[model samples]
Target chain A: AQTVTQSQPEMSVQEAETVTLSCTYDTSESNYYLFWYKQPPSRQMILVIRQEAYKQQNATENRFSVNFQKAAKSFSLKISDSQLGDTAMYFCALRTRRSGSARQLTFGSGTQLTVLP
Target chain B: SAVISQKPSRDICQRGTSLTIQCQVDSQVTMMFWYRQQPGQSLTLIATANQGSEATYESGFVIDKFPISRPNLTFSTLTVSNMSPEDSSIYLCSVALGGTSTDTQYFGPGTRLTVL
Candidate 1:
């Protein structure tokens, strides 16, 4: 069994500033994937960024990036140059592809982010 | 990235009734999944709809409760049977466009079901 934890229940960031959302997971599997998903007010789940456990380098997608520390079992998301549109509920998810097991995602409770102007 | 749409974006139904939500993807996908997001909670995978086979459900979920239909690679439906207030949640449909195990998945807008 795997579990993802987002310690922060809510976060706020001023416009044009940067914000970091923390995430940690527990998994025995060596090969896995970590993802950050954003659900806006419209209720649309959007993929923010993803990190492969095997990759030592962090994953960056424009303003969204991940600080993945495999040894510490930590994967945090950083949103740079934050805008009002970045306000959303962010969730961290983990997925492992172990043999004979279905590919499913285990998500954290989520952190509601508010970008204040 | 694939375009996924779910019909009946939001619905308010009475308890004991049922609601069937349809998911359609613009392109054929390798895998389709259903998830539930309760209020103020994160997403929990309900089942994986496999084409030409029975849908595989996760722990605490059953076929009778969430009957899923995956007729093809691009279309699927999930019916909430004998709904209750506890069933009030956002149901999302997602798809994996690639065959790799680590491929990214695209999500639909989600169908909001309110059981009153």
Candidate 2:
């Protein structure tokens, strides 16, 4: 079984500033994938970024980047130059690399990020 | 990336009523999944909708309560049976373009069901 934990239930950042949301997970599978999804007020789950465990280098997309500490089992997301549109519920999820019935994602509790103007 | 859409974006139902949520993907996908998100809660996997076979449900979920049907590669439906206030939630469907485990699953807009 895989469990994802997001310790911070809420966070706030100023406009044009940066913010980092923390996420930790525990899984037995050696090969796996991690992801950050943002659900805005529109109730749409949008993919923010993804990280592959096999890759030593961290993954970045535009202003979104992940600080993946494999040994610590930590995968945190950092949003630079935060905008009001960045306000949303952020969830961290983990998926095993194995096929069959275990392809579903195990999501964290989620953190509500608010970007203050 | 895949574009997924869900039908009946939001609906309200009385107890004991049943609601069937539809999920449609713009392109054919190998894997489709159903998930439920309670108020202020994270998403939980309900089942994996197989293209031709019966859906594979999670530990706490059963086929009887949440019957799923996947008639083809681009469409699927999930029915919530014997609904109660507890069953009221935001139901979403996700699709993975590739059948492989490494593929990223993209989600639908979701159906918000409010049971009265």
Candidate 3:
């Protein structure tokens, strides 16, 4: 079984500043995927960025980037030039590359992010 | 991405009653899943809704309490039987894009059930 953990329950950042939400997971499989999802007030789970374990490079989308340390079992999401709209509940999720029983991505408890403008 | 929709977006029910939440995907998906989100809690996988067969439930869950029916490829239903105050939560249905086997999954708006 895989377990994702988000240490920070809530975080605040000034507008246009950078904020990083930390996430860690416990998994035995080497071939897997990591994801950062943003859930705004509307409560829609929007995909922010994704990182493949095989690739050493981190994944980025617009201002959203991830510091993926596979060796440390850490995947943190960094939001640069943070805007008020960036405020939301951020969840870290994990999934195995193989299908069937391991297809699902176990999620973390989530961090409530508030971007102050 | 699949356009998934859950019927009865929000509903209020009395204790001991049951509510059936419906999940519909625009395109056929290889896998479908039902999840529950309690207040201030992370999402929990309720079961895997597989077409042409009975849904496979996870630990701490069973068919009698949360009966699932998947008659076709693009649709499924979850019934929360003998509802209680503790059963109130937001139920979501999710599916993968195409036959793509990634960790990424698209979710529906969700059904918010309030048990009184």
Candidate 4:
């Protein structure tokens, strides 16, 4: 079984500031993927960014980047120059391939991010 | 990326009734999934709907309680049977394009169900 953990229950950052949300997971599989999904008040779940365990190079998507530590089983999301729109519930998820098919994602509790202007 | 939409964005049903939520994808997808999100809680995958086969349910979930149907490559439905207050949660439908290990699952807007 794979379990994702988001230590922070809630986080806040001032506009134009930076904030990092921590995530850790336990997985025995060598080939897996990590992801961050954001859900706004509209109840829409949007993919934020993804990091492949085999890739040592961190994944960057504009202002959103992930610090993926495979050995440590830690994948964190960092938001730079945060804006008010960043306020949402962020969830960390893990996906591993098993029996020739990718399994469903196991998500953490989530961190509520509030960006203050 | 895939554009997925769920029908009956929201509905309030009686405890003994059942509600079937429809999911439609703009393009053909290899895999579809159903998830439940309780109030202020994380999303839990209810089952994996695969075309041409039966849906695979996760632990603590059964086919009778939450029956699923995958009629085609771009459509699926999830029914919450014998609804109760505990079943009052958001039901989300997601689709995976390419069906690869690295492919991301795109989510629909989600259907909010309130059972009384």
Off by over 4 Å in 4: A99-102
Q: Model 4: clashing residue pairs?
A: none
**TM-scores, in order shown?**
0.97, 0.98, 0.96, 0.97
List of clashing residue pairs for candidate 3: none
Predicted complex 1: DockQ: 0.77
Candidate 3 regions exceeding 4 Å error are B98-100
- Chain B structural similarity (TM-score) per candidate: 0.97, 0.97, 0.95, 0.97
lDDT of 4 by residue, B1-116 (tens): 77889999999999999999999999988789999999999999999999999998988999999999999999999999999999999999998765466677889999999999
Q: Report lDDT per candidate.
A: 0.92, 0.94, 0.90, 0.93
Q: After superposition, how far is residue B8 of candidate 4 from its true place, in Å?
A: 1.2
lDDT of 1 by residue, B6-58 (tens): 99999999999999999999998867999998987888889988799888898
Ranking by DockQ: 2, 1, 4, 3
Residue B28 of model 1 has an lDDT of 84
lDDT string, candidate 3, B66-112, tens digits: 99988888999999999999998999888877445654788898888
**For this target, which candidate reaches the highest TM-score against the unseen true structure?**
2
Instruction: Give per-residue CA lDDT, model 4, range A60-110, as digits (tens).
Output: 999999999988999999999999999999999998855334478999999
Looking at candidate 3 chain B, the ten consecutive residues that score lowest on lDDT are: B95-104
Model 4 chain B poorest ten-residue lDDT run: B96-105
Score residue B11 of candidate 3 by CA lDDT: 97
- For candidate 3, the per-residue lDDT at B99 reads 43
